[model samples]
Every structure is written in C-alpha cells, then in structure tokens.
Target: MAPKFGTSGLRGLVTELTADLITDYTRAFLEACPTGGTVHVGWDLRPSSPAISEMVIAAIRAAGIAAVREGALPTPALALSAMEAGHAAIMVTGSHIPADRNGLKFYVPGGEITKEDEREILMRLGQDWEIALRPGALTEGTQSAENYIARYVSGFGTDALAGMRIGIYEHSSVARDILIATVQQLGAQPVPLARSDTFIPVDTEAVDPATRTRLATWCAEHALDALISTDGDADRPMVTDGTGQIVPGDVLGALTAQALGAQILCTPISSNTMIDAMPEFARIERTKIGSPFVIAAMESALLADPQAKVVGFEPNGGFLLGFTAQGPAGPIAPLATRDCLLPILAPLTAAARAGISLSELVERLPARFTAADRLAEIPTDRSAALIEALASDPAQCAGFFDTLGKAEEMDRTDGLRLRFASGEIVHLRPSGNAPECRCYAEADSPERARALVEIHLGKLRDRLG
Candidate 1:
C-alpha cells in the first residue's frame, strides 16, 4: 500500500517506506511545484534515514533540479535553511513514532505545504514506485545548523541561562549535538544524559512511564535545573523541570506566548482551555489540530493585523513564530514551522528571569492539566467509525460518556472532544501518523486528567475488543 500523508508529513511502516516510494513521491512533489530550483534534503537519526534521503536527493536531481544535501539535522533546521534560501526541502523522519515506522516532511519554497498542496502531490503520484536508480553525488548544503543556532544565540545572548544547569537526554535524537551546542552557546551548563545510537521514539505529548521514571532519576542524580529533549526529528520539545517533572506542552505554549508578549495567538482546539480565558493575548484563534492548519490561520491573522505580534503553537510543544520576536539578546527571525527550540528557550528564559523553577512557573498558570495516550493496533477506519457513531447521534454521544458523566457538550474540531458536566474533557481521535486511536483528557488536576485518559482508553479498548 502507498504511504499516506499525515498532519505534518507522510508516515507509514518501514517495510512500505521504500526508496522507490521516496523517489516516486519526490518526483511527484517537484512536478507539482514550479518554484523548484535547488532542493534541500535532511534526515533524522533513524537507520533508514540515509537511504530514504538518498533516494529523495537522487529524484530531485533526476527532476533536473540541484539537490543540496543538508545532512542529518533537525527538521526545523532544514526548514529554516530552505526558507532562507528560497528552496524546497524534505526531511526523512518518523517523528515520535516507533522505530518500525519512518516518514517524510516536505517544505515548499515558502514553508510546509497546505492541504491543497498535499492534494496536488497525491494527484500527481503514480500507482507504482519507480525502480531503484543509482544516486548521484549531491553538493553539500551551506551552514544551515550554524544559521539556526545563530538565531537563538543572537536572540537570547550568550550565557543568558548562566545560573541554570540543564540535562539533555540525548537518546538518539538527530539534534542531540546541535541541542547541546545551542545550550552551551546560550551560556547554560548542559549535562548530556542518555546518549544512545539506537533510534528512540520519545513522544513529548504522551510520555511513556519508563521514560518518565528515567527522567526523574536523572533529575535526582544530577540535581538538574531542568531536563530538555525533543522528538525523533527534534521539532517537538519535551521539557522537565529541576525535579525532572514534565510541563505539559499547551502550558508551555502559554508561557512562551507570555514571554513573547504575543498579541495574536493561534493554537489547536485540543490545547489547554486556559488559552480561552487568557486576557493578555488580545486575539486567540484555535484551529483544527496540525501545524498546517495553525500556519494558515496565522497567515489570516497576520493579514488582518499586520503589525500585531503573532505566534502559533500546538499541544505538542511545536511553536511557530509568525513574526520576529524581540528579546533581551536580540531580535530572532521568524521560523513559521513546528520548532522545538523557541518553546524551550522562551519558557526557560521567562522562568530564569523570574528566579523561579520551571515547575513553579507551570503551577502559577490556571489549574488545567492534560494527559494523552493511544490505543494501539486500531485501524483508522475503526477509529473513525467510533467517532461517527457518536457524532451522528446525540444518544450515542451521550451514552459514550455516560459512565464518566453527562456529556454537557460535544466538539468535533479535529476529533470528538466532549465536555463533561464535571468540568472534564475527553477527546478521541484517530492517530494521523500511526495505526492507533489517540485519547486526550483535561481536568482541574493532573491526577484527575490522567485518570480520565486511563478510563476512556479502557472504554475504547473494551468496545474495540
């Protein structure tokens, strides 16, 4: 079966994510865009990345365009470089999914492609992938990593985090070295922890129990000020406070917005509800979950209020700065893509300035907590059927949430998000990147939010079984 595009990119099983497939899609993407000149390609630390990237680079050259290789780097780094050079880019990554899976993210001359662009590429794609062809030696891309670090270095200044001691859990992330270097450049004492060559899928949004325990252990062992890490491609940030406890991504988004003093903020419906009540942000827009949706909404917001400070973030801690934000160090250039660095720096800086720990800063926010998990081995059709059953009939919706509480209201933004009479939320959606159904819950306390996720996931499991 042909791999399909997800929220941010194309993801599928490694068996089906073949070189021929990559080559075929790369050719189709080039055919779909007239602005193609020099294409920039990068990949993650996955074992399959180099081969997939080679296939894509060869296809770019085969299409009569120059393929400037950016080598192994963070997804956002490649995107930042591509945007600066006005060149299209492709990233070989699987994000936070398991190692058995791999995927690709494409960027046009401007940034991530929109839904229309995805449709165009899909329409252009052929039924069968081409036979493997000899890959041509490509030219090395310019100093994109350096340029990306420079953005933060200039924005936050040297040693801005002078008094902070951060631990970087480098468990085979592509940006392991780059992240450590950036922290050092910013004058923060960084402890490199959990360095591994094997690719590890570290989901920031729904962290695993084993990883959580490890983080806590690391924090206790080293007395860290914070622990920072990212997903496979290093676009989504997973941050831990001094005690090695995590701060939910949506809460981090709020703090980052506060730090940026953003006038217009765009997020997804699945984000924390505090955004709705936040008065500091004059304009708050919630889009369907996905960077593309948020990016488009940001475009509309900027067009309406050109001079207003605009920014977008997701519950995954992937931030997009619609405008260059001025900070103590300097003015940072806008990287209107899912970026991990900005979310990390903006919040850490805010806490440092206030002389508070990261956890303390998080607690100061309105009491709203979120927990997420997925029911694995569930097909997309099955997951959609579940939502359709509830959405098509009010009784189904009411009965589905009846055990927990009355379904006070229902929201179908990107999925089925039902608000309970007990001031709790349960959102269920099919995983875009994997064969699973994701469930999210939010409540007044962390324990309650976690319990809701566990309860609802059990419900889904029983129904599917």
Candidate 2:
C-alpha cells in the first residue's frame, strides 16, 4: 500500500516510500504548516531511515527552507529542539514497526501536527509549487540530543536516582545512549545490555513473551532496580521493575503525573481505566487514541484552567508534559509531543524518593491489570469489518463475547471497547501503524487480563482463518 497518514504519522512499506513520494509529502508538509525558515530533521537507526532523511532534507531545501540535520536521534529530541527554536521538524522513523517499513513524523513549531494539519498536507500533495532560487543551506547539529538529555538531568537532579542500579536495554533504540547518559547523570548505575546493530522493533505496549523473559534474565543477572528502554525512534518507553515485570503504561503515566504534581491529565481511551481511580488528578480527560487527540485534550484542559498543571500520556508509555511544573532541580518546560524520558525518569525518581523498589511503588496504585497483544498481518479492512459487525449487532456482540461475560457497555471512541458484566474489558481495534488487529484487555488481576486478551485474539485469528 502507498504511504498514508495514520494516527501518529505517515507510514508504508519501505519499497513504496519512493523518492518522489517522500519529497511530495515533505513539500506538502511545508506548504500546509507554518514552518519557519529553518527546519530540524532527524532519523532513527533503521537502515532505510538515513536515505529517507536525505530525501526529506532535499525536499525542505528545494522548498527554500533551511534544514538542520540532527543525525540519528530520538523523535522527542528532534521535536524538543525544533520547538525550542520556534521552527518545525521532520523525523524519519517507522517507530516499532519492522525495518522493512518506514515512515515520517512531522511537527509544527508548536508541537505535533493536528488532524487538520494532516488533512491540509494531504490536500497539498501533488499540487504545483514554485521552486526556490537556490537550495536552502544545509547544516549539521548535535544540540537536539544535548537539549533532550539536559531536560531530564537538570529537572530530576543528579541524586534523584542515587544508589539505584538500572539496566539499559540498548536493543537498536535510537535513545539507547541518551537513556544511559540520563540515568547515569541522575546517579543510577547504568548497566547497558543487548546493544543491537540491526534495528529491532521493540513495541512497548505489547512486550512479547521472549523479550519479557530476556528482560527478567537481565534484571536478575545485573541486580537491577529497574530496566528501561524505548521503541525504535524512542518516543515510546518500555520500563520494567526489579523482577522484569513491565509496568502498564497508563499506570506509569499516573505515577509520573503524581511525581510532577500535575492537576490535570489527558489520556487515550485505550489506556487502562485505573487512571480514573487516582484522586490526585483534579481533572482527567479521555480522548480518542493517538497523541494528537491527547494533545488537543491537553490544550483544552490548559485553556479551561490556565494554572492547572497539565499532562498527557499514551498506553505505550509516551508521556507529554502540557505545562511547566516545578522539579527538584528547577522548573521543567512543557513539551507537548509524545516523550519517553520524563515517564522513565519520573517514576524511577519517585520510587527512589519513597525508598522503595520500582515494583513496590507500582503496588501502591489500584489493583488494575492491563494486557495487550495483536494479530499481525490481518488486513485493516478485515478488522474494521469485524468491529462493524459486532458494533451493529448486539446479539452478535454478546455471542462473540459469551465465553467471557455479557457485554454490558460499549465504547466507540476509537474502536470497539466492550465492558463485560463481570467488570472485565476487551477492546478490539485495528493497528494504526500496520495491518494488524490489536486486542487490549483489563481486569482486577494480571492473569485474567492476559487470558482475556489471549482468548479474544485467538478467536479473531480463527475467525480470520
């Protein structure tokens, strides 16, 4: 399929992301957004990303916009730099997808582009445009990476994680080095593990069983207080406690917000329902899945109460700071884009401050468990059809979920989220980044949550077969 805009970015098979297509999208983004004269560009470690970055830079220059090449770095790093400079940015990354696929993420001066911006970009595609008199100047910069590291280290303080042993899972994540540096700077003994030259699509939301086993082994071997990692481009974080049990992303969000003393919070509907039980947040808004939606909700929250400390996060552990909040060292600036560092550092620091292990800190929260998995390579159309069938027919929906419990309520914010009579939740949605059917389940216990996801996804697989 041709590259198209999804919930996060424009994505497609690497082969289909030709030079012409990349240039068209790049130019279209420039035309649609208010990009200043200079635009920052960055890429992930994926082999295809370098070439894609070159194409994007060429397109920017051709459009008479100066391009500052930030080299290989995390998406949030590039975004932070661009936002700081009051300019726009383009990141060449597929973000947790296989290396065979690649994509582009665009940011305006303010933050990630909204749905309206995506529509404008699409409308401008293939349209006629005037060429610049000369190619805009191209330059190199490492300031983005530097700024990202400092954002965490300065805010959290050097001793925030003193005496903690943290394992850095360097599995081809562009943020690998930065993670280690930031953790070490915060006084954690960083144990770097499993650095991979080849790109690994580490999905933080759905940690496969094998990767979980590996994380446990690493934590035990290194006597780690916690293990931290990110997705390919590092916008999403994967963090595990001492026992290598991955913390639910929404739970991590809540802890981070609490650490930051946030009063207002925004999250996607797909996130764990436990967020509602947190009494610390004065207001919580649930939007349709996607950072743009969460960002919009955050903007609304800020507008509603300018003094409120606002934050947003995704189920994948990507946190967004919507207001400047006081940190131990200083005041942290707002970064409206999806970020991985804050979530990783805040929770670790909170655990350290409480003189407790990461797992213990998690146990303080409500007893809610969430599990997610996906059936890959299923056509998006097929997944959508299945959802439509269940949504439109109550009998079919009830029958489909009979093995679990009767469907008492349904949420169609982004997909089909069904609440059973027994208080379990089974949500089915098509993956925004790939041809897959994603299943998310929540229960009072981890075992029940995992079983719900497994049983539902297995049923989907059989039906598709």
TM-score of each: 0.96, 0.99
Q: Per-residue lDDT of 63-172 in model 2, one digit per residue for the tens?
A: 88999999999999999999899999999999998999999999999999998999999999997667799989999986778889999888989999999999999989
> Which candidate tops TM-score?
2
**lDDT of all the models against the reference?**
0.86, 0.90
Off by over 4 Å in 1: 34-36, 127-137
Taking the tens digit of each residue's C-alpha lDDT, what string does model 1 give over 342-418? 89988898888888888888888888889998888788889999888978887777777776667778888888998
Number of colliding residue pairs in each model: 2, 0
Index of the highest-lDDT prediction: 2
| Candidate 2 ranges with C-alpha deviation above 4 Å | none
Could you tell me the lDDT of residue 453 within candidate 2? Answer: 94
